[model samples]
Target: MDKKTENFLGIDVGGTHVKIGLVDTKGQILQFAKEITASLRENPLGFNLAFVEVVGKYLAKFPEVQHVGIGLPGLVSKDRTTTLEIPAISELNGFDLKSALLEKYPNTIFHLENDASAAAVGELHFGTGQTSQDYLFITLGTGIGSALILDGEVFKGVRGNAMEMGHMLSRGNSRLEPLIGRNGILKIAARMMDTFPEEVGQLAGQELGMHVLVGAASAGNSIALKTFAEVGEILGEAIVSTVRILDVNEIYFGGGISAALPYIMPSLDKTVHQYLSPYYLSDIKMQRATLENDAGTLGAAALCFMD
Candidate 1:
């Protein structure tokens, strides 16, 4: 009989779609596929059961895979057995996902984690950089997601959802995500364009999307530049406070909007330095995460390595 080679199955469950990857031990994805989340929810058996049934399909294809990892969008129980308060998929809220998977695939071992934390784990395991044993990770996308890595492991606070920097209050007592997330950034651009009509260039008549803002910033549009500057300031202030509490110096930025890190850096750096003490600012490192678009898929795969 041929010796069974070790390979892992990774599932990244998002708000609208699910990313599945067959990953080897070194974090390389051998096969990849995507599924529409809503389509699964429409199954007669229900979302949870449909999800479990789908995994069986993958398992049958990769018979040697004995470990499966799943990355979720929201808070999970401390034991990692249940998903809690999932905003996007109301059906998954409080569902005992692990138990269901275990019951269906009795011979397989499963791992589950929050998507943000899973991404952090992916960085620790596969990212290209000076991977720090301790650091802060923030994803700047539709909603801000954050995770803390201490001593090369995810730091799950009192409840499993510790580093929620997105929800932290910032200027005007507003949550950080709402102020600098995707929609928030667009709103900023709109406000800037309205305030500085003369500075508007390519962005004036075009739809004010992040892509447009990024393109305009790349072309030296003054309003776009100013918009990112303000975004950096808001993000920086949050980092200043976070560093004070976590005492971590290395920070990684991911997500779609992070593509404009260059535009946000000057202000982000200035804010951190302006508010933080010499000790806190001594060796602060803020850079883009390496995985890029593959973060979610690779992150889910990285979960199997946690053990």
Candidate 2:
């Protein structure tokens, strides 16, 4: 009899880097490595090719990795062949993702999903869903993406594209991305620097963004502090718009931008409170993401079990 080598692999393909993991069925990431994702942007067809190389290099000794999954930042066609166009990761648009992965790993079963959906799946299975039925997982990175969890599974309204709160119109009469997304935060910071050149003179010497804003806020820079507050306000209002309607029990904020939650929570809470009805606030609780970066990988692995 042959030994059944049991192991799984999860890959997170982002705009800047790729994270590949050899993992366990219990959702624990056992080994991982990263490479420049820019290779795909320059050579769109190289996404999977590069993945294969990275997987070969790192997991070469772990032949148990017979199954693999990927998390992309765009909507996936029902067939998993397409990465529908998205604003942030433009390189993956129109790529024949499913076929490419299959071609690269003929011996492995590949599962692909939207990164937000992957994160929600991870949260549902390993992070938070074990405790609650209804929750929303928000990824606050360069761009905001989210997954809606209803009754323990990802809620895709009739069509697969639902829970796109990041694109909601909540501020400046512009789409949510321009005001609350990372670029939106940068936009806000740039405008602030332009408006108060002296107050933000130090910021004027360089580009403005979440990192700079967080630093300035931490050091008591009023302008940057105000910018983070504005982001929190806009983001909170947008989130409230969706949560109030869904009446979910909780919201978990994650992603790169979420690292600055401490800087934005005040305004976010204020806005959430203002828009939420007394009954809703009393029942629903908003909190920061606890899983951190692992949500993407764990979520990607879940595609092996979930649609």
Best by lDDT: 1
* Per-model TM-score versus the true fold: 0.97, 0.83
lDDT tens per residue, model 1, 1-307: 1113477888999989989999877778899998889999999998889999999989999988888889999989998999997888888999999999999899998999999999888888778877878989999999999999998888999988899999999999999999999999999988987899988978767978888899999999999999999999999999999999999999999888889999999999999989999988887899999988888888888888776
Off by over 4 Å in 1: 1-5
Model 2 error, position 253 (Å): 0.8
lDDT of 2 at 131: 41
Q: How well does model 2 score by local distance difference test? A: 0.75
lDDT per prediction?
A: 0.90, 0.75
Task: Please give the RMSD to the true structure for each candidate, in Å.
Answer: 1.9, 3.7
Candidate 1, residue 217: lDDT: 92
Which clashing pairs does model 1 show? none
Query: Candidate 1: lDDT over CA atoms?
Result: 0.90
lDDT of 2 by residue, 159-186 (tens): 5778777777765577787667788788
Q: In model 2, where is the ten-residue run with the lowest total lDDT? A: 1-10
Error of 2 at 224 (Å): 2.0
